[model samples]
Each structure stands twice: as structure tokens, then as C-alpha cells.
Target: MTAPTAPPPRSDAAVGTPPPTARPSLLRRVWTSYAFRRICQSVFVVWLVATITFLLMHLMPGDPIEIMAGRLNSSGMSHDQAMATAANIISYDPNANVWVQYLEFMRGLVTFDLGNSLTNPSKTVFEHVMEYLPWTLFAVGAGVVLAVVIGLSVGMAMAYRRGSWFDHVMTSIGSFLTGVPNYILIAAVIVVGYTMLGVLPFLDMRGRITAGVEPGFNFVFFGDAVFHAILPIIAFAFTATGSFMLNMKAATTEVLTEDYVTVAQARGLKAGRISRSYVGRNAMLPIIPQIALQLGTLVGGSIVIEQILQYPGAGQMLMAAISNRDYPVVQAAVIILATSVVIASLIVDLFLVRVDPRIKSEGQDA
Candidate 1:
């Protein structure tokens, strides 16, 4: 029997054209993108923060117009005149529909035009914010940097000497300090350093700079500003450093017990090298994101600390605005602080992906 007629040779075209690869759906592609999710989350967070702040301010007990009227009355205006002037200055009808005001406010936010302050109509809210932003940035930025450095070093050392007296002492100190409120710490510094010992003669307890120093980019101004900032920085750093140190200590302790650490030790790696490469580097990963978050929070000046020190910063401005019931100033400050936090978190999320590619993989899988 003619050997079962061999099947006709398959045409090359039949084999050459592979099944068309399935293209990813547009929705699937978007959902899987790390940047897309992060941006959406950030937008949602900003909107939530803004909306909540607006609602709370509006629903609060005191009336902004009444508060302004009281201030005008203090400035020697009759009750009727004060109310009329308050209306003129604010130019916002308290009798207007709440929804209408909200729409106007949202419009201003979209345009980045935070309107003028009711208290100081001559200068815009943005002007007030700019005037105080730099001081807060300088003091808080310096404090955060100092805290990170001190905390990382001390924490690593504590981890290296776990169960030793050094570790116990530091841990106890950090725990105690972390429990103390920032305002309390500032008060203590004022009482002990200024009131009790009178040792810090050079310390300017109030304001960002000494009274006579001209505002310019010179050694005198620079030195005076730094000198004035020393106490506030110390207060901030001391309280903040404790939390950082404790966090690092815990992270390091956990990392030191990892399999790789044991392997490094078993391989007879130098202690310093093992600590640097296997322990320190890995331990720092958790803290790095925290550092970024803290730096972001620094934009919102420590309200209690700034108020106590009378340092001209955003916190001080906010406190003043709240007292005066200046809606624009208050809203702008909250928006700026909230926006900074959201943006910082977004940046840190992206940065973490760069620092560790595994994060990107994990994000994709999620």
C-alpha cells in the first residue's frame, strides 16, 4: 500500500504567520501604570484635604465678618461703620449662598490666585505667605537634616551594641524624648536655658533675626539669622531626633538578623564592610522614605514651636490668620501645606522606585 500518502507539505505561509499577538487593552494598560495610579491618588488626596479644610473653616462657630467687625471696632470705628467696612474690605457677601462662595474659592484655587487678606487688603495672601516661607524653610529644613544625621548615627551605634549600656541609655533617652510634646520641649528650653542658667546670652529667644540686623545677603545678616535660629533648631532637632533614632534602631535591629547578615558574618567578611554593605545599607531603606516624608512636612512649620519662639514663619502667619479670621490667608496656608505634603509623597514614591527597582516590580504586580 503506497506508504500512507505523506500529508502534503504544509505551506510555509501557514506556519510563518503566527497568531496575532493580543494587544493590551487601553484600560488595562492605564491601570497597570505606576505613575498613573500615583498621580490619581495624589489628586484625590489634595482634593480631599482642600474640601475638608474648606468645610471645617466654613462651619466653625465664629463668623469671619463678625471677627473682622470686632477688629475694625478696636481700630476706633462705630459698630455700624465697622460692619459696613468689614463688608467692603471682604467684598464677600456673608449673605451669599455658600455654594456660590465655594465655587468662587475653587475658581481662585484653579488660577493659583489666592485672594487678598481681609485683615490686610493691600497685600495679597500670597505675599504674606512668601514673606514667612523662607524663615520656616530655613529653620525646619536645618532641624530635619540635623535630626536625620544624629538619629542615623546614634541608631546604628545602638544597633551595633545591642543590650549594651550604651544602647539601653540611648533607647531610654529616645523613648522619653519622643513622648514629650514639642511645645513642652520649647518651654523647657526657654525656662532652663534662658530663665534658670542664663547661659545662652547670644540666643535670640524671639523672632527670626535680631532687631538691628539688615535683611541682606551678608555675613552679618546670615550669622545673626543662624544665631537666632539656634535655639528653635535645637528644640526641633532634639524632639524630632528621638523618633528618627528609635525608628532606625528598630529597622537596624531587624536587618541585623536577616539571612544575608548571617551569611556575611559566616563568610568572614570584615565587620565594617558587612555592617556597611549588608546591614546599614539595607536598614536605611525604611528610613529613607520616612526622611522624605518628614522633609515634606517641614513645609508646614511646627505651629507650637513657631508660636512659642515667635519666629516669623508660616505657622506664625497661620496662627495670626486664624485669630483674625482671615479666610483667604487661612485657606491659602492650608492649601500650600497640604499641597506640599501631597507633592512630597508623590516624589518620594517615584524616588523609592528608582532607589529599589523591586518596588516598581511590586507596583506592577499589584
Candidate 2:
């Protein structure tokens, strides 16, 4: 009997393949990556941000003591009380050095003790900022997620069906919507919401709902707040979605030209299957960092949308703090916002490296 034919030699060995290189351990690789360097840079940036924020707040023309007391002639406090309050507000004393004051401020941040609000002495800066941060996050968060989902999907579809009627339709709609500023859209939405839809009242700037009621799922206050949030959310989403859509379209268009995509199509892959599983998947890489960058922008920008909607969100607090020259509030807000931005960028950097190994390898080469 013919000798049993040896199973076909494995092509890798048949071609005299070299032994695989031993890859570095995950931890070691990460330690050497650009991401690690970026994180280190971020720590220095935070310190610099904190120092600059403190100096700027202190340098700005105006006294938190005067702002807090409401006047140089306020009758409630004697000279001693006023001086004590001023010292406390400024974190200074006759005996304390600048280093001491800065060290004390940094210590306070560790404990979430941001001191008293110069804009409103009835509350602490932490309380004032924390109270509104939630609402701002809610509004901005909802808008961003909505924009990404709607925009990316639309853009993918437009790009896939380039020059089709649907593509032209989306392009026109995106152009029109993007042309209108968020404030204008919010105004129109408010008018229609109140006058036409009769679904919700105008946004309340005084605070989220009347002060007495707690925010819960079952209350009219909550309902009213959500209804009011809709217009601002829509306005924010509309203005932002167009950019996401345009970017996604560009990314997807580039991805669709890859040889792998053509090969998949030749292999009898369904159009929908290839689009979602292949093209769309790869196209999302660029979008990831972009989304993080947008998050930073939105955090800084939420105040504008919040003000327009008369929403008692972080934006409103920022506006009030700026108008009153409440250095404490302004400094705290800037530090918090700046720290967030830097952290977001760092997270995005790491995420991109994780999603695309090329980033890590290329970074090493660089």
C-alpha cells in the first residue's frame, strides 16, 4: 500500500518560517508606551493649571471680601469680623508666606473643601459648583450621546451610498442644521415647545424646579425640568450632530476603499453585513479620540447652552461667578474644568493606543 500521504506540511514551517519573536509583557510594554509619558505630562499640567489659576484669581481686580460682604459699609460685621473674613477668603495672614497659602489651597482640594463662595456666602464653592454640575452633566451628556449615535449612523449611510439621493438629502439637512447656531435653535425650540407643542414650559433659570421639591422620577418638578431640558438638548445636539456626521462620513469613505473591504464584497458578504461588521468597525477608530476631544469642548461650553436655556447648571454658576468677580468660584471652576479636559485627553490617548496597536508600535519607532 502506498505510504499514507503525510498531511500537507503547515505552510508556515514549509516556507522555513523564523521562530516567532517573544513579545514584551503587557505591563512592560505599557510602561514604555507613549500613553505612560502622556500621563506623566498630565500630572505636571495639573500642577501648572492649579498654580496659574490661583495666581490669576488673586491678581484679578476685585476683592472677594468686598463681593462677599456686599459693600464696604455693610453693617452686619465690625472691622475685626471683616478682616477675619477677608483673611479666610483669601487664605492669607500677616505671618503666612505665599507658599503657605498655596499649600493650604492645594490641601483643601484634597479634602474637597473648596472654601466659601464669594458670589454667594450662603453656600460654599464646592456646594455651589457641585449642585449645578449634575444638571450640566445631564444636559450635555444626553446631547453628546444623542449626537454621536444619530450623526455617525447618518454619516455612515451617506458615505456608503455616495451620490445617492439619500446622501444628497443628508448633506443638505446637515448643512442647514449646522448653519443655525445653538442659541438660535434653542430659541426656536423654546417657542415651538411652549406655543405649538404645548408640551413643556420655558426653562427655569432660578434653579432646577422650585427649591422645595427634591429631584425624583415621580414629581412634576422633575417632569418640568426634563421638558425644559429637551429644547436645550435638541439645540445642542443639532448643532453638534452635523459635525459628527460629516466627520464619520469622511472616515467611512476612506475605510471603504481598503482592499479588505473589496475582498469581503467579492466573498459574497452582504452589503449590510460588510458595512456594519467591517467598514464601520474600522472607521470608528478616528472617531474615538474626536469624541473625547468633543467631551472637553462640551464641558467648557455647557455654560453657554445652560445660560440660554436659563438652566441652573454649571454654566449659569460660571456666568454668575464671572460677573461678580467671584475669584474663588472662577478659580475653582477653571481648575475643575481644566483638570477634566486634560484627563479626557489622556484617556483618549490611551484608548486610541489600545484600539490600534499600530499607534503603540509607531510611537516606539518615533
* Tens digits of per-residue lDDT for model 2, 1-366: 788887875876678998799999999987986877888899888888889988876667756556554553386777667767765765523344768878888898778787877646778897888887777777777888999999999999899899999999998888877777777777787678677998655634334666566667786877766665776577668867887888889999999999999999999999989988899889988888877777777778777777777777888888888877776788788888788778878887888888788987887888
Clashing pairs in 1: none
TM-score of 1: 0.88
Which window of ten consecutive residues has the lowest lDDT sum in model 2?
A: 87-96
lDDT of 2 at 230: 72
Measured by lDDT, the strongest candidate is 1
Give the alpha-carbon lDDT of every model: 0.82, 0.78
lDDT score of model 1?
0.82
In order of listing, the candidates' clash counts read 0, 1
Per-residue lDDT tens digits for candidate 1, residues 1-366, read 557777788866778966667999999988888878999999888878778878877877776788888888998989999988888877766667889888888888888887888888899889988898778778877998899999999999999899999999999999987888767877887888778988866345568778878999899999988987886687677766988899989999999989999998999999999988888888888887887667665555378778777777888889898887787888888888778778877887887777778888887777
Q: How many backbone overlaps does candidate 1 show?
A: 0
Give the C-alpha miss distance for residue 202 in model 1, angstroms: 7.3
